[model samples]
Structure formats: C-alpha cells, structure tokens
Target chain A: MSEFTRGFRAGIPIGIGYLSVSFTFGIMAVSYGFSWWQAVIISMLTLTSAGQLAGISVMVHPGQYLEMLFSQLTINIRYSFMSVSLSQKVAASFSGMKRWLLGFFMTDEIFAVASAEKTVDAKFFFGLSVAPYFGWALGTLGGSVLGNILPEVLMNSLCLAIYGMFLAIIAPKARTSRAVLCVTVVAILLHVMFVYLPILNRVSSGIAVSVCAIVAALIGAWLFPHDEEENEA
Target chain B: MREFFIYLVILVGSTYLVRALPFALMRKKIKNRFIRSFLYYIPYTVLAAMTFPAAVLATGNMLAASLGLIAGGVLALQGKGLTLVAFVCCALSLMTDLIMITLN
Candidate 1:
C-alpha cells in the first residue's frame, strides 16, 4: 500500500473510536452549560480523554485551577514521551509546516496506529491523523447540538464504548506477549493502590496515577526479560 | 467574561503546548533504545491503569462492580471481543438492577 493509504487505513479505527467517544464528551460539555462552539473547540484543541475530563473539572471548579493543572500535566506528560518515541518514525525531510500540523494530532489512537505500522513514513502518520482530527471536532459538535435527545440509559451505554475500544487495543497485545501482560498488571495494581489508599487519595489523581503507572511499568519491564528478537525494530 | 477568556486561553495554550512543543524540540530522531521501549509501552500501561479502576469499581457499588467484573472477565477469557465484553457486562448489570427493582 502507498504511504498515504497505509496511514488512512491505520487511522480508520481511531477515527471511528473518536466519533463515539467525542460524542459523549460533547454531550458532557453541553450538559455542563458550555456553548456548542465551546464544546467543539475543546475537543478540537485538546484531544486527550483524561485531559478533557480534567478540563471539565476546571470549568466547573474554577478555583481549583492548581489541582486541575497538576492533573492535566500528569495525564498529558506521557505525550511528550510518545513524541520522542515517534521522532524516529517521522521523516527528516518533513517541512516545518508539516511538523507543526502533525504535532496537533499526537493522540493515543493516532500514536498507536502510526507507531504500529511497518515502514510507514511521516506522511502516512499525518494522513492517518487527519480523519480523527475532524471526527473529534464534528462528533463534539454533533453531540453539543443534539444535546441529550437520546434516552439516558442509551447514552450511558454509549459511554462504555470508549472503554471497549481501549480494551480492544490492549487485549490483542496482551494476548500475544507476556511483556504487555506484565505492563498491564503493573498498571492495574498501581491504579488500584491510588484508588484504595487513603493517604494517596489526597494527591491529584492525574499526577498520582501517571507517576505510579510509569514507575510500575518501568520496574516490571526491568524484572521481566523479554526475548531479544521481540525488542528489535 | 474575562474568566471565560482566561479559561479558554489556558485550554488552548496548554493543549498546544503539550502537543506541539515536543515535535519542535526533538528535531532529530530518537535512536535511544531505552526511551524508545519506554515510549512504546507507555500508552498500554497508562490506559490499563486508567481504565481498570472504573471497570472494576463499576461506579462506586461493589455489588455492581463484582457483577460487571464477572461478566467482563468470563467473556474476555472466553476470547470474546472487547465490545462484547463491555456491553455484555453492562447489559447484565442493568438487568440485575432491573430485576431487583421489579422484585422490590
């Protein structure tokens, strides 16, 4: 397949997933009394799920800016890490314009799709990123405009779809490799700790969860020796 | 009105900062093995941590979470797809809720 086609094909699942999840986010922002444009703009500008959730908290509790900032910083700090990982994949020939444009769409789904592909260049990743970019903006716009026309139960059910997508992405990897499984287990344990522990409960969730997950995953990877062949690029 | 703009500025600027800054700074490729491996697995690890608590807790009630957990775990272990696992668990939970409601 051509680079463009590969990118779009890779990006297709992400686009579909964005449509579903961003719809929920749109409904949420509107329900919280944001204008339709505001809902649309938020989804466009900030593509991260947890980041958007944190933003909602900030919108509701403006005085808690510091808390929200910490949470958002925590949740999104991983993106920098992903960007560094992707630096090798993106072409050296890419123009400054392309770099800036591509930077706008460094989402989890986009990252997954782009990074997983074999021999895809920057153009391909950029191509895949485009559809989700619009899908999110439009999905949020539709949700904001539609504004709870559906039954509450149905809407609640739709919310689970995002989690479903997440599971689908990780489960396939976990099924194949013990390394992924170890990472998944470590992450879950760390999450449970913060959720259950009283002392940790005071910490801002974004930071606490991010730190614990990263630390745990790093330690797990260090202890579990994966076969060398699997690690090669 | 000013507060609204401030919030807007923060939202836009922060989003741009997180997304845009790295690509600009890391002009060359990252050939480092350790950081690359760390980046490769970070999303899955982060996502597991993020999603598991909510999926397990299933919204504050242990009974509901346990029921959902059984449905999800069984279906997942059986090699059903994720949509099936999540929806089936949720549907089962909803049915349980309805049954109790009707019985009462």
Candidate 2:
C-alpha cells in the first residue's frame, strides 16, 4: 500500500531468495578451491548468480577462460535488454551517479518489479534493491564459511531452490495475462520440440530457447498490440 | 599469485565493460523501433534459454526432466513465482537423482 510497506514486502522475498542462492554460490566457489574471501568478493561484485556459477569452471581451468568469458557474456547479456526496458521507468533527472549505481544492480528481478510499478521513481527502486543486494553478499560469505558443515543431501536440496524461485516470478504474471500464458506455453512447447529433435541437438539449449522465445514474442506482439491504457504502469 | 591477480583484473574489467558502457552512453531515450522490439522479446528468450537446459537437463534422464517439467509447469500454472517454481522443480529432480543413485 504505502511505499514503505510496498518496499518492505517486495524486499523481503528478494532478501531471502538471494540469501539461499548466494550461499549456494559460495559453497560452489569453496568447493572449487577458491578462497572464502574470493568467493565473497565475487558474489558481492558480480551480484549475478549465473555469472558467478560459470566463473567457477573458468577459475578452475585457466585455459578455458576465453570460452567461459564468452558463455557468461551470452547468458548475462540479457541484462542489457532489461536495462533498456528500465530506461523509461528510471527518473529522467536521476543524477549521473545514481544512474551508474543503479545500473550496477540492474538485475532481472529488480527490473521486473521496478518496471511493473505504478510510479517510476528512482528512490523506490533503490529501496527495493538494497535488501536483495545485502542478502546476496551476506549469503555468499556465510555459505562459504559454513562449507561442508551441512549434509550433502540438505545442501543439494537447497541448490535446487533456484528453479523454484524462477517459477514464482513468472507464474503470477502468466495467470493475469493471456498473452503471457500463450507466450510461456509456446516457449515450453518449442523447448520440448527442440530438445527432442535430432537435427537441433547440435545447438545448445540456451541458444534454442532464445531463438524460440524471440520468435514467439514477435508473433505475440503483432497479434495483440499493446493498448495505451495497458502500457501505463 | 600474479596469475590470480591477472584473472581478477580481467574478470572485473570485462564485467564492468559489459555493464557500465551502455548506461553511460545510452542516455537518449531508446527511440529505435527495431531496438525496442529486440528488447521486448529478449527477456523471454533469455528466460526460456536459461530455464530449460539448466534445470531440465541437470538430471541427465528423461524421467527426471519430465518430473521437473511437470513440477515446474504445475507451479507455473498455479501462479507461483519463477524463482520458487524453478527452485522446487530443480530440487525435486535433484532429489530424485539422489534417490535413484542410492537405490541403484
């Protein structure tokens, strides 16, 4: 309701979710034989789950750094797309400093929540971001420090928590919008077909899904043009 | 130690390069229609790309992938969040693998 309340409600889940994901990353880093502080610093600076995960294999195999770099770039490049969408929501007069700072934290979840807001003020978005950032950094530190303390079964269970986190974000949006529903369904169907097709096996799953979703979205947008009313907030 | 620092420098530099440059230069409202269309579909494409291979294939078998898909799809249909559903389905699939491993 109130900005403070809304900020608090939105921030808590992000905080809890980041805590777990970051913890997993930290454990992964340590398991890969990186120093605890190296893991913590990576989590803090990158603030990206996938990037950090991929960083490990890269760290382990120095010769593969080039391939790792390209792969991470491919996976995380979508953030630039998120930033472009967020340009409208961000304050026109936000100081250059604020823009730089906010851009650093321009994550998928943050962009989703901020872009969907009724008011596109800079302060509110910053407030929402603070909790998740703190959670992620702390979680990495804690997990790395606590490495091997937990049973393998439990640790493995927590690792899968990430997929659940993704489902939570998309499902709600799909329920309200038939457009979203159709797009998600189409994407899933295409995913299955691509995965099963013998000819398409050469392509990585990431590339295949990216191609299918982009095609589906263009078709969806053409079929159902956005109304001015729906576009606002 | 020098190698580590070199790696760190490259990693940090490369990361900042990818993220910071666009924000600095792209102050103008993104007016290009083609660019706008590209941005609109990219997230969906990225999400689908990230989700299917990583989560679904992590299990190394069709049964686990199917279980994951069902779990993921059901949670997705019931209006759960992306992170939650992805995490649950992945966990379920992983647990299935662990059990199968133990049994075998």
Candidate 3:
C-alpha cells in the first residue's frame, strides 16, 4: 500500500474517536449562544478539544483578548513538545513549508500515530490529517444542528472514547517495555497528585499535564536510557 | 460578533504558533542520548497523564468510567486495535450507566 494510504487507513480510528468529542464541543458552542456556523468555523480553525472549549468559556464571559491568547497558549502548550518530538521523526523531505503545514494538523492522536511510524513524510502526515480534520468539522456541524438529541447517558459514555484511544496507544508498548511501564506509572501518579492535592490542584490542567509528563519522562530517561541504535532500528 | 471574531483570531493564532514554531525551527535532530530517549518517552508519558484521573471523571459516574477504563486497558493489552478498544469502552460505559438507571 502507498504510504499516504497507509497513514489514512491508520487515521480512521482517530477520526471516528473525534466525532464524539467534537460533537460535544459543537453542542457547547451553540449553547453558549454561538450560531451553528460559528461553532463549525471554530472547530475548523482551532481543531482542538480543550483549547476550543476553554476558548468558548472565555468568549462567553467578559474576558479580555489577552485572556483568550494566554489561555490558549497555556492550554495548548503540550503541542509544542509533541511537535518538537515529532520533528525528529519526520522524513528529511519534510522541511520548511511542509513542516509548518504538518504542524497545523498535529493533534494528540495524530501525533501519537505519526510518531509510532518508522518514518513520516509530508504526504503521509497530510493524508493522516484528512480524516480527523473532516471528522472534527463534520461532527461539530452535526452536533450544532442536531443539538443534544442523543441521550445524555450515551453522550457521557462517548466521552470515554478518547481516553480509550489513549490507552490503546500506550498499553501495548507499556506491556513490552519496562521503561515505558515505569514512565506510564509515574506519570499517572503525578497526575493523580496534581488532581487531588490542595494547592497543586490549583495549577491549570495544561501546565499540570506538561509538568507531569516531562518529569516522568526525565526519570525514565535517566533510569533506562535506550541504545541509539535501538531507536533508529 | 466582531469581538468574537477577534477572540477567535487570537485563539487560533496562539494555538497554531504553539504547534508550529518548534516543529518549524527544530530542523536538526538532537543526537544527545538523554534527550532522544526523553523524546521517545514523551508520547507515552503525556498520554498516560492525560488519560487517568481525567478518564475517571469522563463519564460523570466514577463506577462506569472505571469499568470502561478497565475494559479498554485489557483489550489494548491484548493487542486490540484502537477502534475496537474505544468503541468497546463507550459501549461498556453506556451499558453500565443504563444498568444503574434501571436499578435506580
């Protein structure tokens, strides 16, 4: 199979998974007094779940423009780390304008799948992006137009789907590698502490998540450094 | 409406820059062993951190969400594909919610 086609096929699950979350986002934007088209437009442009939801919250309030900018920056900062990491994985052909274009579509799920590959090129990355991109926009359109027609229980259940995808990405690797298993455990412990602890919990989730992931990965790297040859192989 | 459009611009610009700048600027791959390993572990750590505690709260009911998490984890460990794992989690969580509703 062609590389682009391979990537597109790999992305189908992510596209399906995005439908529920973006559907919720659409309903939310509409409820916040946005028109259906506005909701669709936001999804098309932002293409992020937490950032867009937070954006809507900020917009509905008497928030300043700086608040919108800072909130999005803070909430979406993890993408920077993911983007930097992914830069190492892309094929040499992906440079300049290609890199910039690829960055626009680098959602967490897409990043995970792309980084899993042996080598990623511009065509593969763009093809991988197509399904989730349209899934997000189309889901928003459906949600805004349909508006909570699905049962609440089903909606709540569907919210778990993304987390399910996350687990699918990590679990098999964790099962095979001791380093990965430790990193996963440490990250989860740190996350739980951040969520339940008093003052620490006050930190915004975006920052908290970034810190937890960084610290856990640091410990994992220090303890179980991989052979350079193994990584490239 | 114009104000909303301005806010949207700010939102899109900030978020896009966060994703773009690092990928664009970091043209050369780091050869450092530690940093490369760190990068290797980043996806797993980040995904794990994002999934837990948050996934517990995903379905509103902790019980149902936990069930979904277990189901997803087990299925994934068995080498199940992403689509199956995700849909099964949703279905399991929904069934748990429905069963609880019927009982209540």
Candidate 4:
C-alpha cells in the first residue's frame, strides 16, 4: 500500500476520536455567546482543544489580545518539542513549504501516530491530517447546530476514546521496552504530582504536561540511551 | 467582530509559529545519542503524562473512568487495534455510567 494511504488509514481512529471532544468544544463555544459559524471558524483555524477552550474564556471575559497570545504560547509550547522530534523522523525529501503546511496540522494524536512510523513524508503527513482536521471542523458544526442533544452520560463516555487511543499507542511499546516502561511510569507519576501538589497544582495543565514529558524522557535517555546502530536495524 | 478576529489572529499566530518554526528549522537529524533517545522516548512520555489523572477524571466519575482505563489498557496490551481499544473503552465507560445511575 502507498504510504499516504497507510497514513490515512492510521488517522481514521484519531479522527473518530476527535468527534466527541470537538463536539463538546462546539457546544461550549456557542454557549459562550459565539455564533455557530464563529465556533466552527475557531476550530478550523486553531484545531486545538485546550487552547481553543482557553481562548474562548478569554474572549468571553473581555480579556486582552496580549493575554490570548501569552495563553496560547504557553499552552501550545508542547507542540514545539513534538514538532522538532517529528522533524527528525520525516524523510529527507519532506521539506520547504510542505513543512510549514504539515506543521499546521500537528495535533497531539497526529504527532503520536506519525512519530510511530518508521519514516514520515509529505504524502503521509498530509494524508494523516485530512481526517482529523475535517472531523474537528465537522464535529464543531454538528455540536454548535445541535447543542446538548446528546445525553451527558454519552458525552462523558465518548471522551474516553482519545485516552484509549493514547493507551493503545503506548501499551505495546512499553511492554517490549524497559526504557519505555520506566518512562511511562515516571511520566504518569510526575503528572499526578502536578495535578495534586499544592504549588504544582497551580501550574497550567499544558506546562505541567511538557515538563513531565521532558523530565521523564530525559531520565530514560540518561539511563538507557539508544544504540544508533541497533535503532537503524 | 473585528476584535474577535484580532483575537483569533493572535491565537492562530502564536500556536502555529511554535509548531512551524521547530519543524521548519530542524532539517537534519541529530547524531547525539542522548538527544536521539530523548526524542525516541518522547511519544511514550507525552502520551503517558496526558493519559493518567486526566483519563481517570474524564468521565466525571472516577470509578467508571478507571474501569475504562483498565479495559483499554488490557485490550491494548493484548495487541488490539486502536479503533477496537477506543470503542471498547467508550462502550465500557457508558455502561458503567448507566449502572452507577441505576444504583443511585
């Protein structure tokens, strides 16, 4: 199968998982006094759940544009690390304008799936992006137009799909690799600390996630650095 | 409306720049063993960090969410596909929610 087709297939689950999350976002945005079209436009332009949700609050509260900029930069800073890591995985031919375009669609789930591949290229990146991008936008449209129709229980349940996908991505790798297992455990512990500790709990979720991932990965790297030759093979 | 548009621009610009600059600037692979390993382990670390307490609280009921997490984790470890794991997690969480409601 072609690489693009393969990537497209891989992205289908991520796209499906995005529907419920974005649906929630749409409902929230509309309830915040945004028109349905405005909510859809925000989803199309931003394509980030946390950032968009945070942005909606800022807009509704008469916050400054500078506040929006800082909030987005802080919340989305994790993408820089993900993007740099993905940059190394892409084929040499994946460059120039395509890099910019591909970067635009670099959501967390897309990064997870794309970085899992042996090699990423322009076709694969674009193909992987299509489903989730449209799923996000279309889901927003649906939710904005039909707010609160779905039962709250159903909505809450559907939110688990994305987390399930994350587990699916990490579980097998952690099972096989001692380094991955250690890193996963350490990251989870760090996240728990951030969520509950008095001073740490004040840290925004985005910054907490980035710090936990970096610290956990650094520890893993220090103790179990990859052998270049073994990795190539 | 114009103010909203400006806010949108700020949000899009800040977020997009962070994502784009890193990808666009880093054209060559790093040969450093430590950095390479760090990058290699990043996806696992990020996913794990994102999943834990967040997933536990996802369904608004810790019990139901935990059940879904365990079901998803076990299915994934058994080499289930992503779609199946996600589907089962959602279904299980919904069922747990229903049972909790009935009991209440």
Candidate 5:
C-alpha cells in the first residue's frame, strides 16, 4: 500500500473521535442561536475544538472582538509549535503553501500520530487529514441538523469520549518516558493552579492553558535534555 | 447573528494565522538543541493540560467525572488501545452519572 493509504487508514479512528466532539459542538451552536449552516461553516473553516467552543461562548454573549481573538489565538497556539516540529519532518521539497495547508489540519489527535513518525510525506499528511476533516464536518452537520433530538444520557456519555481519546493518546507516552511523565505532572499542576486562582480563572482559559503548557515544557527541556537518538528511538 | 458571522471571519482568520505561522517561518528543520527538545515535549504537556480538570466534568457531576478520569487513566496505563479505553470510560462515567442522579 502507498504511504498515503497507510496514513488514511490510520486516520479512521481519529475521524471517529473528532465526530463525537464536533457533534457536541454542533449541538452547542444551535443552542447558542447559531444556525446549522453557521455551525457547519465554523467546523469547515476552523477545525480546532477548544477554539470553536470559546468563540461560540463569545457569540452567545456578544463579547468584544479582541476577547474572541485573544482567546482563540491562545487556545490554538499549540498548533504553531506542533507545525514547527512537523515542518522538519515533512518532505524538504514542499513549498510554503503546502506547509500552510498541512498546518490547517494539525489538530491534537492528528498531531499525535503524525509527529510520532521519523519522517512525514506530504501525501501521507493529506491522507491523514482528509478523513478526520470529513468526520468533523459531517458530524457537525448531523448534530446541528439533529440538535435537541437525542436523549440526554447518550449525549452526556459521548461528550467525554473525546477527552478519553486525549487521555489514551498521552497516557502511553507518560508511562514510557520519565521526562514525559514529569512534563505531564507539571502541566497538570499548573492548570489546576490556574483554575483555582480567582482572578486568573476569569482570564481566557486558552491563555491560561497556553501559559501552563509552555512553562511545563520549558522546565522539561531544561531538566531533562535528550539526545537526537532518543528523539527518533 | 451578524456578530456571530463577523466573528467567524475573525476567529477563522486569527486561528489559521496562529496555526500557520510557525510552519511558514520555520521552513528548515530546527537545529537548536534546547528548542528542539522543547518542541518535542510540547505535545505531551499540552495534551495533559487539556485533559485533566476538564475531564473531571465529563459525567455531568464532579464525582462521576473524577471516577471516569481515574478509570480512564488506569486503563490507559495498562497500555490499552484508544478505542477500548475511551469506551470503557464512557460507560463507567455514564453509569456513575446515572447512579448519582437517581440518588439525588
């Protein structure tokens, strides 16, 4: 099989994972007065979940544009770092525009699988993105169109599936690497600290999360430097 | 909905900008040792930060959510695959949430 096909096959689970969460997002949009089309468009244009949710909150309350900008930017800035790492792995021949297209689909789940590779082919990246992108868009369409129809229990249960996916992704790495475990602990501690701090808690959650993650990562870099071999190994 | 529509443009534009910046600027591979190490760990820390605290709200109540988080962690710790771990936690959290609701 071609590398693209391999990547596409691997992406099936991620697409399903995104469907569950973005389905919730679609439901959320309608409840907040957005039309089904708007919700679908949102998913199509911007695939980031936390950022979409934050922006929807702004829509619900009609917050300042700057607040929306700051919140979404901070929530999604992790992608910048992810893309930076991915840029190295992508084929050296890819142009700036191609790299930008790859950046568009670097959601958390996709990044987890993609970055684990020693080298990334452009075709492979496109294959990986297509299914998840479709799943996200289609799920949003389903949810917004079917909003308020499902029983409460199932929605509640499925809502956590995405978080479960997140745990599944990180837990393995944490188990294998001491440095990873340390970084995870530090980030969690910092997040908890921010959540409890009254003034800080009111700040954009994206910013808070961004700060905590960056700090934890910085500490990890300084305290537990690894050789290049360890990276690929 | 004009506000919503307008913000859609802003949100999508800004979010895309944030995501695309590093990819555009860092065309070459990172050679800086500390920076490379730092980028390597970014995913781990970021994912961890997003999962916790928030995961505790999964089941409609703190008790069930907490239980679900612990159960998910344990399952994941055992080196289970993604699908199995997620489904187990979803089921566990749903049951805990129902039990809590009926009792109250």
Candidate 6:
C-alpha cells in the first residue's frame, strides 16, 4: 500500500477512538450554553480535548480574559513537549509548511502512533491525521445536535465510554511493564492528592495533570532507566 | 455573541500557541538523555492519572464503574486490543447500570 494509505489506515482506529471522546465533548459544550455550531467550531479550532473542555468551563463561568489565557496555556503545555518529541521523528526533509500542518493535529493518540513509527512519511502523516481531525469535528457536531435527543440516563451512562478509551490505552501497558505499573500507580496517587489538597487543588486541571505526569515520570525514570541501547532509539 | 467570538479566538490562539511552538522551535533532534527518558514514560503515566479517579467519578455509578475497570484490567492483561478492552468495559458498566436501575 501507499505510504499515505498506510498512515491513514493506522489512524483509522484513532479516529474511531476520537469519535467516542469528542461526542462527549459535543454534548458537554451544548449543555454549557454553547450552540451546536459553536461546539463544532471549538472542536475544530482548539482540537485538544482538555484544552477545549477547559475553554468551555471558562466560558460557562465568568472569568478574566487573562485567566482563560492562562488556563489554555496550562492545559495545552504538554502538547508542546509532545510536539517537540515527535518533531525529531518526523521526516527530516519534510517542508516547513507541512510541519506546521502536522503540528496542529498532534493529539496524544496521534502522537503515540506517529512517534512509534520508524520514520514519519509526510504523506503518511497527512493521511493519518485527516481521519481523526474530521472524525473529532463530526463527532462534536453530532453530539451537540443529537445529544439532547438521548435519554438523560443514557447520556449519563455514555460518559463511561471515554474513560473506557483511556483505560484501554494504559491497561495493557501497565499489565506487562513493571516500571509502567509503578509509575501509573504513583501518577494516580499524586493526581488524587493534588485534586484534594487545598492549595494545589486550586491549580488548573491541565497544569495539575502536567505536574502529576512529570513528577510521576521523574520517579519512574530515575528508578527504571531504559536500557543503554534504548537511550535515544 | 461578540464576547463569545472574542473568547473563541483567544482560546484557540493560546491552545495552538503551546502545541505548535515546540514543533516550530525544536527542528533538530532532542539529545538530552534525561528529557528523552522523561518523555518516553509520559504517555502511559499521564494517561493513567487522567483516566482513573476521573473515570469512576464520571460514571457517577461507582459500583458499576469499578466492575468495568476490573474487567477491563483483566482483559487488558490478557493482551486484548484497544477495541476489545473498551467494548468489554463499556458493556460491563452498562450491564451494571441496567441491573441497578432494574433493582431500584
């Protein structure tokens, strides 16, 4: 198969996964007083799950513009690090413009699959991203418009679906890897601690998550450093 | 309407700023051992933290959510793929929710 098709095929599963999460976001945005189109637009523009969710929360509650800015800054900061790591793996000869385009669609799921590749082909990158991008936008649109049509109970129950996706991503890794299990457990504990702690609880959710992830990973790295051959490979 | 538009622009701008800036700046390879190892462990750890606690709370049915998580965990340990794990978890949670509602 062509490189583009290969990437697109690889991304199809991510698109399916995004549908579940973005659908929830769509319903959430509308319930927060955003119109259907507005929710779709937000999904289109922000493209970050946590970032868009935080934006909706900001809009719902009257907040300073600066607070909203800071919130966005804090929420999406991890993406910068994720983007940087993926940059090294992307084709060295890829054009600057394509790089910019690729950067915009770099969600965690996309980054995970793309970064794991031996080499990121530009066409593959394009094909890989297109499905998830439109899938998210469409999912949001559907949720916004059709969310109300569902029974309240069903709507509430569907909330578990997104978490299911999250579980699927981590459970397998933790099962086989001792270091991963240790870090995962530590990360969960730190996250719970932060959310309950009086002072730290005030931290924006995005920043709180980043801090917890970094701290847990720090401990994991120190304790279980990768093999020497695996340093940069 | 106008205020909404303004915030949308600001929110979109800021989100993109952080996400894209690193890609723009880091054109070359990341050579630092510490940073590389750090990023390597991040996805699963961060995802683990984000999923748990929030997952249970999100369902609002702790009993059912816990059941789903345990089942999902077991399935994942058996080398189940993402689609299967998600499917089984959602189904378990849904069944639990249904059973509880019926009992009530």
DockQ, all models: 0.40, 0.36, 0.60, 0.58, 0.59, 0.54
Score residue B69 of candidate 3 by CA lDDT: 85
Candidate 6: chain B TM-score against the reference chain B: 0.74
Off by over 4 Å in 5: A1-7, A28-34, A57-61, A112-119, A226-233
**How many angstroms is residue A78 displaced in model 2 relative to the true structure, after the best TM-score fit?**
2.5
Docking class of 2: acceptable
Better of 4 and 6 by TM-score: 6
User: Which residues of candidate 6, in runs, are more than 4 Å off?
Assistant: A54-59, A64-78, A196-207, A226-233, B1-7
Task: Give per-model TM-scores.
Answer: 0.77, 0.73, 0.77, 0.75, 0.83, 0.83
Model 3 agreement with the true structure over B62-92: per-residue lDDT tens digits: 9998998898899999988767888888888
A51-113 per-residue lDDT for model 6 (tens digits): 787678678755457767865765466687778767777777765777776678878778878
Q: What TM-score does candidate 2 reach?
A: 0.73
Which tens-of-lDDT digit does each residue in A145-199 have in candidate 1? 8766865544544444445555655776787777878888888888788878899
Using DockQ, rank the candidates from best to worst: 3, 5, 4, 6, 1, 2
**Model 4 chain B worst lDDT run, 10 consecutive residues:** B27-36
> Which pairs of residues collide in model 5?
none
Please give, as one word, the docking class of candidate 4.
Answer: medium
Give the poorly placed runs of model 4, Cα more than 4 Å off.
A1-21, A24-39, A48-94, A107-128, A143-147, A228-233, B1-11
Model 2 agreement with the true structure over A1-233: per-residue lDDT tens digits:
65645665777777877887788777767777988899887877777765566556566765545555565565566676566556655656654777677677777777767778865566776778888899999989888888778765555555555545555655666677676667667776776778888997666543465466666666656664433222211
lDDT values for all models: 0.66, 0.65, 0.82, 0.81, 0.78, 0.76
User: What is the Å distance of residue B96 in model 2 from its true position?
Assistant: 4.3
Instruction: Give the runs in model 3 whose Cα sits over 4 Å from its true position.
Output: A1-14, A24-39, A48-94, A107-124, A144-147, A229-233, B1-11
lDDT of 6 by residue, B52-73 (tens): 6777876679888788878877
lDDT of 5 by residue, A1-233 (tens): 99889999989988887777677678768867888999999999999876787677676666578767766665676677677767777777665777777778888778878878878887888899989999999989988888778767756766666677668778888898999899999999999888888887886666666778889989998999855643221
What is the lDDT, from 0 to 100, of the residue A105 in candidate 2?
74
For each candidate, what is chain B's TM-score? 0.58, 0.64, 0.77, 0.76, 0.72, 0.74
Error of 5 at A85 (Å): 3.0
For the candidates in turn, chain A alone yields TM-scores of 0.77, 0.71, 0.70, 0.69, 0.77, 0.80
In angstroms, give how far residue A100 of model 1 lies from its true place: 1.3
Worst lDDT 10-window in candidate 1 chain A = A224-233
